[model samples]
Target chain A: MAFSLDTVIYMDNNATTRIAPEVLDAMMPYLSDYYGNPSSMHTFGGQVGEAVTQARQSVADLLGADPGEIVFTSCGTESDSTAIFSALRTYPEKNHVVTTRVEHPAVKNLCDNLETLTGRKYHISRLPVAEDGTLDIERYKECLTDETAIVSVMWANNETGVLFPVEEMAKIAKERGILFHTDAVQAVGKIPINLKDSTIDMLSLSGHKLHAPKGIGVLYVRKGTPFVPFLNGGHQEKGRRGGTENVASIIGLGKACELAAAMMDEENTRVRALRDKLEKGLLSSVPKAILNGHPEKRLPNTANISFEYVEGEAILLMMNQHNICASSGSACTSGSLEPSHVLRAMGVPFTAAHGSIRFSLSVYNTEEEVDFILEKMPPIIARLRELSPFWEED
Target chain B: MWEYTDKVQEHFTNPKNVGEIKNASGTGNVGSIACGDALRLTIQVDENDIITDAKFKTFGCASAIASSSMLTEMLKGMKLEDAKNLTNDDIAQALGGLPKEKMHCSVMGREALEAAIADYTGVMLPMAQGEVVCECFGVTDLEIIRAIKENSLASVEEITNFTKAGGGCGKCEGRLAALLVESTDKQSSPATAQKKKKRMTALEKIKKIEEVIEREIKPTLKKDDGDIQLIDVDGDFVTVSLRGTCAGCYSSQTTLKEYVEKKLREQVLDTLIVEEDK
Candidate 1:
């Protein structure tokens, strides 16, 4: 692990992160000698059940919710689907949903596929965003109506890191008696979220995004909200979600949540400073490099920069030579010929959209790594510009 | 992440002939800034009709640049006629292979080569004169058809991969799907020779009727000191109104029943009926 870390500079934390050491240490026993089924009527299984309860409490504490409100699932996608389908099934009469135009595919695709899933047509109001990738609350409020069943929005955009006013949106949605759900997969660990005071009906978060192992996720459903089971099997998760508990990953996620709560300050301060420095250095050194997303209202860890007249895949390949890792919003990288939906929805021009790069930092990132990226990026952009047909000498 | 080949990586990193050949015999430019990938290829031909030198300046992703570079390398010292016959698959094969999604990069190279050849010979390629299918990218039906024929593309998605025809807005997917069937049907066995004409769903009929009225009818009417508006469509019946000079014209009914219905039937559906809204 030490040797691997020395050679690689990973900045694509929003995509996925390396599991934290503490999370792994806490999960090792579950993966080894403590592999008892939590549901068995035996002392060994009883001990495992106790550990599972403790893990649920840890996750609940991180979100400032009651432990009973938490339902463990397979992944963020599953959690999102569960929360959304539950609301749809509970209010079968309602045929409308409100969501943002720029959503992670988890919520966006599910909303898009609602008609096919339920065998009934749905009217979906997709709220558009501004040029800065931020939504207008007025437009959102206008979309909510009496026929609306649920309002699903992302807390932070995966590509742009633009934060939405989900709390305020949820409040507005609640007044209309509509269930509000936020896919906070990218926001939970990076920012402070106190669901206890919020009007949000349901929240979904994935473990891998927050430095826990993959295949673990949490859906926080406020008590007394109308609910339906997405997965039906032997009573598990209070019959809210069914499947045997993913013991090791559940333990890891609990530890990861605890660590996230403890390190929230460092993530906001040091990581935010490093991200700003990286952004400033690249903007100053590289000509025609503009930042994507809202400048002030964004996640601290993410910096999406677009270097015009140069393709993102070429820039990423060039960066690969220096052992630097990042992600792109370019269509070429996504196996499609258009840039990310978020960038396109924000009206990012073709040149910039084709060349946008997303650098997502984490608590593990260091200032030295930031400096190394700042040093290596300018020449990469310059070299790509030299080959670009649109580049001018000025 | 795309699992690009070593040769693709090599050419992407150390691309060959990365400049313009000024005063060249022929130059072919394809794509645009709005299209996300553009190529400007210049070639110099000798008296023997041999390409003596070739160079390109590209604005696209890694595969696009590599395809341009590979096309130039393949064009150098080659006969003009042979270069004209060079396929996009050849360009991809020369660089081991490109990702399936990036095949359009190679197609762009082939297009630029054809455009350059046309520039030299002063002959417009048949595809260049064909009807534009995708207005977002200015991709023509002949171009999409040729790519579909050459690549044996089976779906709209594959056509997008090869020629970028339906990659934008996606208003042309139904058209592309029809074209895909048309091209593939020609290659099928006699047992499956019965051509299946696409039946438009109700939603599709409404969209197509509106599009025809807006795109084909309204503009022409407005040009003749007249205007037209589509009121609604219920099944085969189309309700419209002629405004401006047409509202009081003596031949307005004849224009509606004959010209308007004829154009709508030809462009959208054959069973359409025209009735002016009273």
Candidate 2:
């Protein structure tokens, strides 16, 4: 069995990705050689601290944000927690929070835990998502009440990869004097994010989800936003997050950010082309596959689709056998008996929900990999459907 | 992801007897567009009532495809009687095992088989005899009972997987619970009948079920911001209703199978299987 060099495709970029060698190279020195704590008052520590500051500037430079606004946390989840909790704490007078039904589990689960998380009464309105997985701006506007503390929406969805009208949302929130936060984990790397151009109060981004290591993230809090720290221990992160910095990871994240700044062109061109190839090939090759998510307004590297009658996990497992990695929207994959909220919120039929699969590409992916996936995917779907009971009747 | 058994993965990867058989003698189709899973089974029986070929098409998760594949493989050389006797549990067992949640996949196999049999015989499926229970799956009484009797289903979830019953908005869970009780009672009643009757009258089952609902069940659930509406009563059959917040609650299946069935089994009959009014 001969395999071509081009056949290895890594389509699941949204889950996580391989750290760029350059980012790893930038981090190794901090990991092994410069072991002194950044807080220690010595040349050795001061140098490392300066490097952290430089790294902060590198991250800020990419987002069109100020270095002081970038608060490095452990991961995107932590950043999300910080942004959401900070909003609620800062505006205790406001009892309501506004979010979308299609947010990632980090946000969705927190919303679900609001009753337990808050000691007092707090109301949260999970705005409905449209059939294409985008939040209805009109409905989102309608949901904003005078007592709303925050309007938290992700800039781009992780599952559907559907881009939200975040600027409009932030503007609406600002007009009402409500703070806005966005879980921009998926958007920061793939899309052009200019903080100077938007009224977003707090935005969250993760490192590993980009090319950096797992335990690093950036929470961009625009200069004068009402902020209360979610963590309380010391004066680290300017009383934002309290912890000894993960210096190596932070450096890696900074380097990754720099690489992202350099690679934004490839994302819009090569990565998008590959994604389109993968999407178009799968849809055309397969008999009854339907693409999920917004057609034109989604992440360049992500494509969610449903192969009418075949379940997603089944396809993922089949793909796993060939080392062809992918993901699914089946309840079996989400650890809930129900399907992914993102797909369900879009009102995808139940018969189609289990069959949903997500193919998220990245700059690292090759054209040959897309073709290989194109070759393997339709057959997998075809085989699965053949055994499908629905297929039998039809 | 679920802690899927190795057995489950194997069938998912290499499903057997996939594709539709042209001019197949009978086809069984079960589940619906909303239930999230649908299975179709086609069989070509030779002159001897021996299945010469079986092909399946399924629209669902891995467990479903694997179950249908396994069912097709299992039935290819078997007689129709054995296939009729086959339950969802059997299909899962044949595949080594499945996740507890995926146990319904095997039940879908059995359902598709029964539907195919009904289509082949041009007879009404026993499931078609009662009201549709799971609005999401379009499951009926006969389907639920057959699932219970064949798989020894004891929970709402088990019924859901096999027949897609009580897997939707869950309004019918109360009715499904009542059905479980009624069927189980019928199964366990023959010996108690000193009158030498092969089965209890549908009237007797309904009366006993109503008495149990009025005495033991209705008052408790109603207090918890839930209400039960009894929909129908037929031979060895009883249908109750779920109202208020319970009607729209997702865990209605739990209340129906766990609370309702437990009550009916305690007061009415031991082997009863509840079916929702679709």
Candidate 3:
């Protein structure tokens, strides 16, 4: 299954990125020679523990947070769960949570089952989003109350790549004495974040999303945030998380974060341009192709477009023939009768939601790859539209 | 990913028999845009009741489009009676089986085929006469019951997977669960009851009435921020009180009779009568 860059145009970076070669090289020592337990009371293990500490520092520097605040976990989903569970345990009197309706299932499903988690009834206020996939901040503020334990929102939507004003929202939550957690798995590397100047109590980031390998994630806790351990086994992660360290992935993620900090400008400039060109090309060439998220206030590397009358899964399968990788919000792709919850929450019309395609770029994507996708997308869409019963030539 | 079979992929990629047949003998349409899928089927039947030609147009996902394409292919040259008897499972098997969640797409195909046959024959199908149970999908009680009985479905989730009922806002889950229990009970009992109308003991009637009240009546009402409480049961006369938001609503009587009473009579016994306790 080894694929060459020449053979495939990988535009699904928002789903997961190809591991950076430098990150792999940095992780090799830990994977092979330096495999001693980080907690062992010996020099060999002490060296590994020092590597872990430096990795923590690198991740902290990337987010502009204190090194002590970064606690590594298995993935973004686990980090999200830990943050909310910690807040709920810390504030035992509160029995309500506020979040957006468009959150990834990691947070949405967790909030939906909070009663089971806490063994008591808990109310959840899911703020609705506008057609542009942006939240109504006024509605979000209205949802906060004395019974609200925490407000969990994603920094950037995974489906639409629409950025939320989490910094402002977090500040509002702080003024109300409510803990705030942001799932920044999609936002951490794609945007500039300086948590030192922000009131976000907890932030989650996944490694594989930004050129690191999978199985490594960071949950940042502001220095004085009240905390309780989600995992209560061994006293690892300063008793905040109880599992043994995922050492190799930790090192890889540190390298990835350092690289992300170095390439932030290029990502905004070059990757952003590629994304725009692909979007514009598809919209102009393909009939009934519409953009999904907010026009300007979105991630630079992501573009979601919907081709009416054609199904997204069918469009993606056609793209697969050209080795062009992308994702869709189509019901067929999900194996469910409905499309992505994000699109449905946005009130995107039924005709468009079923055909939405998400193309997320990375620093690795090229102008050539963008052109290739632009070249291939129009005819594929036209062909499917011809097959579609609803499609009519204009 | 759905792990679609090779047959499914072939049908989805290069779907056959697309577009509408001109001067079709019969046509059937099912689903809606808001429901996320729709199909329009056309067929030309000869004087001998043989399908001479078939065509389809679909607006849906892969399985939906493929289901439509597969249905048209299955209908061409098929006898009208044989086509009328086609089941959703038959459509799925034709395409080497759809995903469990996508079974509803096949069900849509079968339903559209039945509708088209009805259109040609000028006879109303039983489903048209059945009460609407799932507003989201326009699935009827007869359709849900048929799917459950044919597939031996035991849960609301299974019913959703098979028929797309309760898959939307989920306001119909209680009704779906009741239908599941009802269908399962009918299957377990012998056909002698349907022929002889067996009588039940007083305790048996009370237990059956209470079970329907708790399982079928309360949940569907609770979704609308309403509740129902059983007051007393004596012989065929059952009394209940509407609590919560349902207590003073103008439609409480209608809810009591149309929904509560209808469900009790269907599930417990046909002679059972429900009265609102003022």
Candidate 4:
């Protein structure tokens, strides 16, 4: 199966997406002709500030937030850091944080090193997930206490696409007077988000996860939320974030958000159907294959399947041979000796955890591409099973 | 992604001799699913003690599968005695070269081969008799020491890269560091004893100190954005200045005594004393 690069099928949108053509078109002028410092006093640069304001408004509209609440940052990690750090800074006497065990490294690592980073000993309650990768709200409620400063959880897991009850969790934390943050990097555009109806105080989103360029992100800080600036510089972002505006990527993100809003319906209907087709085809065709996350509470365009008795790196490399792109949670793929922390926290067995593959589709994926994957995957699994020591004939 | 060699990609894409041989003379299975990679190797030895046929089945990453395939290809028609002497380095060399982190794959191949040979001879393997140092991969002290000696490994990071000893929960890192020092001490003792018989002149001592500082000490410091310059060599006291991030660092004294001085003592003369220049 010799395929040209032009015909490559991409299904790793959770890792990153191809920049949308509309977004590129919107950003071209900003990159070449409209190159101006948004902080400059002159109108030439002041005009760029207007575009930034519009982008902020567009982002807020998508999230059902006020433009004043949106603080543009470098990326999702920066947003996550800023949100958590701001909460910690707001309540210095509080020494406890509530989070989930299956968080992305951006949030997980920050929570792990909070004591070292802040020079104060802090207790972290990392709430565990169930076998199907859903959080227990009862357990989440039990973790919050008077000493808890904030609760941080991801809206959707990047590896399994498992959706957490972040809204309910946020409401519970709000009743306790604790700040709540959600890393919505994977969930922002894939699912419906109305932050106005929700109790989440802060939310983090990355531009590249959608069809926008990288290096742009948004941290939604609710109005009147006690805040401290992570990066203190000039009065850019009203002194919230102190960096020169990433003029072009910010504009591109705005265009991408507008496009995502219009395509959300198709994302949940058409793209989700393709994901289901691919998932069902692989699980039914490949023996001993199992679904990794919650069957229905997951992202619409994501499927994580584990082909037992095989290694994920081998599966991914074989998939690469067919110009099919995906990601894996195997220890070998990550250069760590342990499998994905998310899968492990969900109690996924080693037999499946070592071979988990995540296919995160985007609106750009076609049914034909899904069919092509279905056609190519069974043989690939069979070939690898033939070479696997633990694989048994059914 | 790993920068796999063309040969590694070739073997992984189209692996040869992939299967289990029925009623084989000897069969060896190493690793497990929980550890993320495993290999089962079988060999058929003729009456002449030559491996007539060899095949393998592996559950692992591309490098592991490629290593097993390359090992089987290298094993076919080789004498049992020659196979006994084969090291993991030989398997890696045969496959062009594996990534430093993926070297454990070749190590797995060698272990499977050794187990197979032990089964053929009905002898218990000595490497298996040692205490398990890395519970994650079930690697033993004997295996760790052998990897260190064979590969000239210097750090815990390298041990993890080669044998996967401290790659897991890393509870065994302290044990691995002790084992490393034990192995390197044993390796250098004989040479140290031999060198102790001769007394070096002042010029020779200074030259040897300078060489060690440049070749051994500088690179290690530079990794941490630090540098060292040899200032003076008076008798056994070698004066050096720590530059860059090492300058004015609170842990510089510990680095000087534990790392720089220890390295100088091992590579140059055991009596050499290193002092930070005031």
Candidate 5:
């Protein structure tokens, strides 16, 4: 129950992250002296708008898109809805949507809600994941049709950290002339993404997931894409989205993106090495521990493992005791006497699904932290297993 | 985050009386490994059906271990019949109180007690006909009723522990509870000595469940380098937890319900239910 500055090794960065110092430094001006509205009538505010334009240009440079294509939103979820809703409403004649069953709730739940919200006219075709948590390209191809208005898929999975071939999927949708959108919330920092090279029409990113503050996100709508505003209000975001900017958060997000680009190599190398240490240590020491995502093509800093026969909450509690914060697919969900849909979608058994634990790291994690986790986890697993009726006689 | 009590945390950190008893007059085990908890209870009974000594070894989270320890304490010096009549809620009450999700741990303790008593009596338990539900925990019908009858247990979670039914693949919880309600009526309108043999003793319940596992559940799981262990039994409900490679196996729940519970139902109680402990 005590709080400390004791380097509490946080491996659940996917849940959210501490704001980077550079991001804070970039946002400080906006919160204090430069607080005028970017849409104000005077030059003081107009200069602030110029800074915003420069920030937007930085974002555009990273994604290889034009500054005009980037529209700011509250978070990844809002961006997702905007892309999805824009596509659906722009082409009302086509009422079918092709999406993966493994999409984040921002897309999945919204699609689920459409049945009731739209009087059941919008048909959603949910593609299933393979045992490896990858989508079936052929099955995906089969699901698309002339009646399909939108093809939405996540660039990477939040739980398993499995990357999808959104580029290929978006290309297919392009060939079929269907609008394509991707929730890149989990991949914007860890993986390389170029909007200029791919036929991807829309993409979404959350600022908090990439070490900026929360309450700011981005939606990259490719030039010439059909657009509809989800939020209806003041003429901000060039009428693409409504309301004044989350100026401080948006400034922080831009700075975070700059930091991400500079750290991309370190993220892919140093952070991944720490991640591998955590992963390999758990696997070698803990017998029968199963990794959840594809071994080769996973996020550099995310590891999801299932310890046999133990409940997830118990494991998390023990980890919390050591101030080693992570997450479990079962421990962090809303009321539903079920494991995470992501794990279940991959056909993970209930026995191990209850035991699924996730450790998502960030640039802040170090080798000492990884080693500390390595030292702490096996005993925790063994201790929990001792209480578990499911573990074997050994 | 749940506001766990200090008592709950204390019991969790320092659970008492864990490990299997070597030899004893009666042994009661409850819940399943697949459901993430189970208890093996051993008791020594005097000629007068008085419980002289009791010990327990439990494999479960903090709640299960604490509840089992608390149950062992409660059972000491009590008549076997009195101990058998103890309810899961009573066991929970003894430990101050557990979180709602952890109520099943206390229920497991109570189920284990009834099972130990049944073993001591040498009763030829009947509960040999029921349906399989909860493909995750390997639960059946007769098991649920036996838990209710032996421990005077209430609620869906209690039935789960004593029976290993709803803890996994929760698809069968409602059906298991329905069977439990149905069988209370059936058991009330009873029969004779020969019919009483079908009443389901703790040992008999274990024996029947083991038979089903041997005949059906193990064969399928073994194909996947997995296995299950019979930990405890209360009345008709027999508790068997998962172990080995099976512990982390993804299809483990499917094996429990589709294979384990299904087999038990084919041989066990028609109106009984099987479920898992929390």
Candidate 6:
């Protein structure tokens, strides 16, 4: 069946979210009539600069941070790179960095290529996760030492939606005098975060994952954190980053953050309930279906489920037939010939890893959409299982 | 999204002959759950060695399912001897061509068919006897060589796309490259011998060059609104002029050297030097 935009059910918010109507409304004027450069000497541009300042304030309010600490970059990847590189440059003597095995490739690939990128060999300790996709705090603490320049860990796993105790990990890094950064791209708006009360030196958040447009992200650096610019150019972003402000997206992100803050309760209650309903319904209806992450410690809006004996891409394509959008950690879907690193790090069995699907809900997802998935998903799994050679009916 | 063809989508949505054959003549199972795709093919053959029935169960992506469905459909009402000659390209063509990355699905279909044939005939497969090259996918050197020969694969990346070799961890890329060079050299030894003798007459050389240009090069260049014209041939050096959008273009020299020269070398003679007639 041909899919229409109106009927498309988007449950891949962890991948990216739909731009909220309010956010778009806030950004339209900036995109059209308010085309003045934010850094211009004229009043017309000064007004745009004021709007940028107000947007920065809104983003800061959402994160419980000061406006000065928010450094906007192109995307979450840039924010993550800026934070980690700033720490490494600040402590040139340190030759060790600590992160997790399940980090999004933004941090994972950066760490993996550090030696080749900088021509300096740095020891990296990737903390392993338990089978439930939860990290051992003690193991993370043991990996940290005086040689460690920065400890970068994700606040939540993108593939599994498994939450990590970044707050506690950051506090531990603080006691040891090591800079700590968290890639909170998946966690920021889905859950409550108050960086003002935390010891985290840096946190990264992307706009698109939280109802804003793509190409806008924020790196929250604490007031006293020493930093270096990743992109060295004209003085913008207070010399912490150097690029012309993506003005419209920044405004959109600010509006989105405000909306995310206001809808946090709805996200946790209604959206979470919908996610639970879809997850529970699929698990009950589909035989051999199992949840991929910790039941209680994951994101409220994300559900990772594995239907054994069926490949994830096949399941996703079948779901795509119904115009139900989601993502998969399967090797075939990722084009990597391996399942998700997060699931691999957690030691998910190959039988399940090859078939993992992630459905991440947003405020826009309706109960009716959840019901539609519950009805469509089971039969899809059954159909794929019937095609799967490994499947054996019990 | 893998950009599946309409045929692939059709077969995936409503696959034909998707079940285990009861009391089958032979059942072949290749791949594993760990590899992210597996296929179990069962065929029923008559006393006359005709495949009366064929069915498949595949655990993979849409391409794999589509390839399997297409394979089963192609197999029914075919002589077992003729079915043994069926290749992955035939399956891919039947499905209106799979995505390049998903070519291994068709290869898997072909392997399953071969295994099923071997099972029916009570003969051990020779391809399975080669030393394992890609540990991740359990692809062997013999299988890789066969795929390289059959598909005319030139690069490690193409080999990976076709056979899933060097697709994981990439530890065997060097080995894959060595095997590729070895296979191509073995296939081109006779051509190399001909080049060494400088055996081709000037008339023959011109004819071969024009044939290659007409059959191979012109269609490729025309895709980009470009054309090539053969100007002169002197011993081993062939001169050509680029016309249309390709004429005097910034990268026309690159096109002449990297593409035109390379294609002429591969098809006509390896020692043939191609120069742009500026």
DockQ of each: 0.32, 0.26, 0.26, 0.32, 0.13, 0.30
Candidate 2 has a TM-score of 0.76
Tens digits of per-residue lDDT for model 5, A235-264: 999999999998888888888888888899
All candidates: TM-score? 0.87, 0.76, 0.84, 0.86, 0.76, 0.86
Candidate 6 overall Cα lDDT vs. reference? Answer: 0.90
- The interface root-mean-square deviations, each candidate in sequence, come to 6.1, 7.6, 7.2, 10.4, 8.9, 12.8
User: Which regions of candidate 5 are displaced past 4 Å?
Assistant: A331-335, B24-65, B76-78, B119-278
Question: Among these predicted structures, which one has the highest TM-score?
Answer: 1
Residue A377's C-alpha lDDT in candidate 2?
A: 87
**Per-prediction RMSD in angstroms?**
7.9, 9.9, 8.9, 13.5, 11.5, 16.6
* Per-prediction tally of clashes: 0, 37, 0, 0, 46, 0
Is candidate 5 or 6 superior in DockQ? 6
Candidate 4: stretches off by over 4 Å:
A1-5, B187-278
Better of 1 and 2 by DockQ: 1
Tell me the tens digit of each residue's lDDT in model 1 across A39-139. Answer: 99999997998999999999999999999999999999999999999999999988778888899999999987786888986667677799999999987
DockQ of prediction 1: 0.32
Q: Model 6 off-target regions past 4 Å? A: B187-278
Cα lDDT listed for each candidate: 0.88, 0.80, 0.86, 0.90, 0.77, 0.90
lDDT score at residue B46, model 1, on the 0-100 scale: 97
Model 2 regions more than 4 Å off: A1-7, A349-352, A389-394, B1-14, B19-26, B44-52, B79-81, B117-278
lDDT of 6 by residue, B40-146 (tens): 99999999999999999999999999999999999999999999999999999999999999999999999999999999999999888776777788987788988
First chain TM-score for all predictions = 0.98, 0.97, 0.98, 0.98, 0.98, 0.99
